[model samples]
Target: MLRRGMILVFSVLLLLSGSMTVFAAGKTGEGATPSGIPLAGLEAFVDNYVKEYIGQKTVGASVVMVKDGQVVLSKGYGFADVEQQIPVSPDTVMEWGSISKLAVWTSVIQLAEQGKLDLNQDIRSYLPPDFLTRLKYSEPVTMLNLMNHNAGFEEYMFDMAYQSPEEVQSLEAGLRLAQPAQIFRPGEVVAYSNYGNSLAAYIVELISGQPYHDYVQEHIFEPLGMQDSIAYSVVEDRPELLEHKAKGYFFEEEGSFTQGSWNYMSMYPNGGNNGTAEDLAKFAMAFMPAAGEQSPLFEKPETLENMLARSYSTAEGMPGIAHGFWEYPGTLRTLGHGGNTIAFATNLQIVPEDRFAVIIMTNQAGESNIVHGLTKEIVGMRELTETVDLPDTSEVQGEFMAARRPGYGFMKLFPYLTLMKLKPQGENQLQVSLAGMTGSYQQVEPYLYQKVGGDSALDVWPMLYAKMGDGKVEAISVYTSDYLPLPAGRTMPVLIINAVLAVLAVAYFIISPFVLLVQAVLKKRRASRHSVSGAGSRRLVTCLSLTGTGIVANNLILALRMLSNNERAYSEVYPQLVINYVLTGLAVLFVAALLISWTSKRSALTVRDKRAAILPIVMIAVLAGLLVFWQFYS
Candidate 1:
């Protein structure tokens, strides 16, 4: 099934790369050639492209493009409420999602500019003593680490977002509740951290003596005259803006969508901004200005320059992250961010070199062709000349996992299951397969590679490949999740065996009840006496079987929780987590019972009886050990 899925995706990628059209631009527009890559007829191209996806993939979307400090295109597609026949207009407001992180970073820079906060200084210096309670390391985490998203925090999921406005807590309260354990030393890994971003906002609040939301409003939003936009989640107080806000939707089927609840987050600084696409365009434009003009957001051009500078990368010489923005490979360098909420998705990209920008927002959740595919087409990829001396690729071929994954809890082992594999396709080419998607990359230089041809905009290439290590490929960095080498025992064979065992273990218990009933009936019919060994082994087998069955049931529930990702899951996780711990205790009892049964019953059991009982016990024991190793209990 997995192989077929990968093959299907790979085939689609080939088809897309071969037939995809270049998104064009209006020739008469001021910024038409801002990228210096002529997009002849972009307006018509965008219209046709977006028209096809409007009702199918997204109920509504707002798209705006700016060039040479002028609005080249500002258009809305589909219905804000499909049932109401209400068209999405320029005034339609939408959730900005993670693109909201930009305002937080901008605030950080403003503080740095005022000398109220230092980027390199330890963040703990700004916080109240004993504020952080989840550190696994004593290393001082700095503001630079927060901006670079390498603060070593795990991906703590629960309580960060809720569907109810009342569930939203204060920024400080949210940070403390969702605070994740640090599993890596500061600066050692580039795990993207939302808590880190919000923590920076808390520091802003602590220094400015204002709530984080107020600080953004007074300093950033008001300055840009984005009165229609609000930094707060839910925007419960802004009735006017709320009324205009496009209803968020989840695609049900073709030409069908269901309205989803608004995404409310207590740590609103990271991803809870709701605003119009025009307002987001203004924010994107601020990051990139006309050559000699300084942005109104900053006191000086140098501050903006420093903020846009590279802070972290998986490999050196690759364009990775620029403060809060992600760098994309193009003829002209591009920096931007993508965002999502419960029912909306957005993209913001800026070609700083050309003072050109594109902002896309959709009412759809999870996936959007315009937000991802059309935007990628707008900010196109370019080939770079490769002539530098670099290391060989043969030694770097292996499995890797995303750095942005849960470092602790029952979810810790999830990343291992979808390990990314890089196989050598040629001396200078490698095929990457991960999470059911495969793409081919051709090495341009010693350590840099570009995606060959991808059907989807979500393909892993045109990446500024950062091979970050002394002489070996330690980790390869992408825009978002950098890939780290898989640890020992997480190879494909081991994972396949583990999956097979999980399935067989579930199967054993599933069929055992009927098998036992049939055996009892047959014995009664024959009036046969139970074997002495079988009777002695029954208790131990029952204990082991109960433990194994309980573990399977617990995992099944957790898997369902993952699939039904909604507001209630946050409250449900703790109860499920406690069950995981109880199952571990039962597993311990199984081991003890097996030890006693094997030693005490050895003399009485016949070879067939011993073989039948012992193998399953041993198999259950191995399965339990594997689960423990994967940290499934916590």
Candidate 2:
């Protein structure tokens, strides 16, 4: 099934890359070329592109462009509420998603400027004692660390948001509910963390003696005169704003739009802003160096500059993120952040050098393609400066796992882990497979690859690899159109061997019992000359049958629950914990049964059978160890 999915995705990528090239060639006349187009010309070009993009992709979108620290255009495309036939306008309220992080960071800068907080001070200082889970590492997480996404907290997945107002908790309560395990040491790697930002916001709340939502509303939104905007700590609490807000939708079966429920984040500081494009433009404009006294942002020019500087990088040569904005490495210095929910996608870009910024918000899922296209048309994307030729392809062929593992605790062992398999295609070329998606990339420079063809063809960003002291590649980073760049760690062969052994052990349990039963019944004797059909054999078979049946039943129940309840299924504690305990008990019994069968003379096994048993025994032991490793059995 996975192989077929990969093939279909790869085919689509080829079609897209081919179509894009053909579409570019089809263009003619003065507007044919996007490059060197003046700002005046860009407005018309963008207007047409956005209209076509909206017709093709979304129910509606709100776009705002700022040039020279002034709003040049703020307009909406398509219908805000399709059922009501209401056309969207610049004033239409839209969910800004993670773009809300901008305001949160701005608040941090404001506090720092006031000398009310120190950027380098331990964040735990601002919170109540034991606010965060303590790890072995003693290095304190600082404001600087959180802003740069190096605070090292694992992604927290549960209780992140609620579907209804009643389910929503206060910021303090929410933080406690979603408290993440700090797995990495401070400043170790730039794992983009939403929890880290929310923690920072909680710190803001602690120091200012103001609720996170209230502080941002009082300082950032109100000061900017964004009358149409409201920052909500809990999205459901704003039932009054529903009349002005666009309904979120997703492309469903047959490319039809399906309305999705609005989810309210308890930590609204991270991604809970609902506002108009014009209002967000005002917020974006505040970051411009040209704003001077006119800027609504309380941070000084020097402070804003500091906010835009590259704060932390996982690798030396890789383009690192700024305090809040992610760095889009190119010939031009572009800092921006893109955001998504189940039913909405949005992007905001700031080219400080050009004194320009663009915010594109859409009421549709997976519609970031529109945001990327329109932004590039307005502000031409420059080529990444190629530095060196590709080295030997053999050096890069291996497996890698995402550095930011899925946050579901023991769920990391799930097959859904986005592992990367890189196979050399030829000189300077490679085939990359991840999460059932396959693509081919050509090395553009020493360690950078341009995704020339694949389902990920839209990922125009060059892939980067960093090497260790041994001259072997340590990790590789890949970026999708809207996702933060993900660095995947290298893995050795031993892990693969263990995984294979575990699968074989499970397979043996599944089929061997039936085979032995048929042999014993037909021959009216033991299956082998040295084997016995006595108490020891019966005990071993019983243990194997129980373990195999339990695993199947647990997974089937989980699959059914997901199919029926969807999001509601995730709201509860992980169901896998119950299964993990059962598996552990069954594994213990299986090992004990094997030991009894081995020692009993009546169940004496042939050398070949004993050798076969060793694999399954080792596999069971490995499973037991993993249960402990992931804290499922403990």
Candidate 3:
């Protein structure tokens, strides 16, 4: 009876605390005619602004405002799925992406605390033997480099070709393929590499003799009581309770949308984890040294300090990166990480000194601006308004001309075709042409333009707003291109190519049976004359055999490319077309080998058959060479 009473009291206290937070948040900006605005008024303004601004963008978002180490305003807005009509709530499980880096980093520090791992020592000491020899650099990379993103490794999963897990040869092989050459030297410049984080996870696995996800779960999640969190790519038996599992979508062709597949199954630690907002709040609470005993993760204050400190700055001239967060230099210090997947974008921030934190998760790609704007407004910073002011046409025109001048303007083709040109469109608008395409821009504000272009008719041409102040305007470039319809004249060539390929395949299939029948008839007639098949039959057999050999060789090459790089390549024309070529080659090779063996003298021609297998032998050698190239060079 006494324990029941205590439980009731505890529940009441929690209820009271939640009510007070809501009340304080609501009353912040109330009843302010003059002098200074009430705190309630400010809070109301922030809430209303987020609803008004972010809501119109069709973004599903959750915001938590904490003050004095207490949640003041925690609310969810919009829908998790617009089509399904599922509303978002605070309990919604959103992908934390790179924010999981913090949890992994914490585990590393814990290992260090236990004297099992050293942050300053060479990481190769902890890694497997095979991985050590595969690295390009002589100097070993350290844990610090991985934590601060100083390890020279390219982002392996950025390409669209590598979006499927099945395309990779194997987890280990994929890691080998993703390894990057040291661009500068270790600790020279901070370059964020998803591949580097993956390697770190591998190292952790090597040291702990456990899977990366399992290690983090045992050390970080379980200790912190983050019950709702799980590593990325994990297939849970019951995923519905996790809630707010927002589906990711990408613009396939400008405005045309397509659902993106779960692309992070091959590597989870880098940017593929999911959790609830409140659970993350609990995770942030672990950073408070005062909550040391209550927190399950870390007991030392130095761990928090080390993780929050600005470890390095990005080489691309961005703000400094902390252990797993970005540091903003100011009196009001902030540390956090921003995550972006196909459909969702999230930001987790903590201002430990102020005992405040913010978690903003959205289901839209461009909702980051809204999240940033709302965060500043809630924190009583300057309001971001849509200001309209025309720039001096002469200045705008001059800047445009400078961008178009020789040595200043350039074009490149490899990944895609791109070209840039600058010319005047109207009195106040300047036109920039790219890839034989044109876009008209009207100056709405200084360094801001409302751009419209000819390409996809349904494409969204939102206003391009530059952050440059009074200095020269930075050149505006679109990250995604608008899809274009080919000219009427170009359709015939495509159709002709398809027709030719189809006819050839049909003819080959149709002629093969006839050839076999003719050979059978001739062989039966010549059975008494010779023990071996007729010359015509042998010629048909050889043709089929050679064709089959060519097909298999081509297919093996294609499959390897797809597995190693998540892409198909046939020379350089269409890298993805080799998948089909490979399939055709394999089919032809099997049939040819069968036909040739059937026609040859089974017992007497073993040596001759061995010699005939030279083509396949060479093909295997080439395949082996390609595999080696993919592992080490590609």
RMSD of candidates 1 onward, in order = 7.2, 8.5, 13.5
Error of 1 at 567 (Å): 7.1
TM value for model 1: 0.86
**For candidate 1, what is the lDDT?**
0.76
Task: Report backbone clashes per prediction.
Answer: 7, 0, 15
Q: Could you estimate the TM-score for every candidate?
A: 0.86, 0.77, 0.56
Tens digits of per-residue lDDT, candidate 1, 341-415, equal: 888988888988888898988888865578877776787777656665545667677778888888776677778
Q: Evaluated with TM-score, which candidate comes out highest?
A: 1
Consecutive 10-residue window with the lowest summed lDDT within model 3: 406-415
lDDT of 2 by residue, 1-634 (tens): 9999997676433322211110112222223122355544544665567654454456677777776656655666766676765666666778888888888888888899999999999887888887886444789889998887777776655677666667777778778877777766787655667777888888888889998888988998888888777778344456656668888787664336778766577776777788877788778777775745535576456777788898765445555678777776533677777777656778887777776777888888657556666666555545645555558766777766554544445445542345677778877888888767777777666766656567532443445553444767656665421122223331445456656755665565567667767855875653545444344554465565557546544544654654433434134636566776777677677777777777887765655555655655665566556445444432
Give the Cα-based TM-score of candidate 2 against the true structure: 0.77
Q: What C-alpha lDDT, on a 0 to 100 scale, does residue 401 get in candidate 1?
A: 86
* Clash-forming residue pairs, model 2: none
Deviation in Å, model 2, residue 391 alpha carbon: 3.5
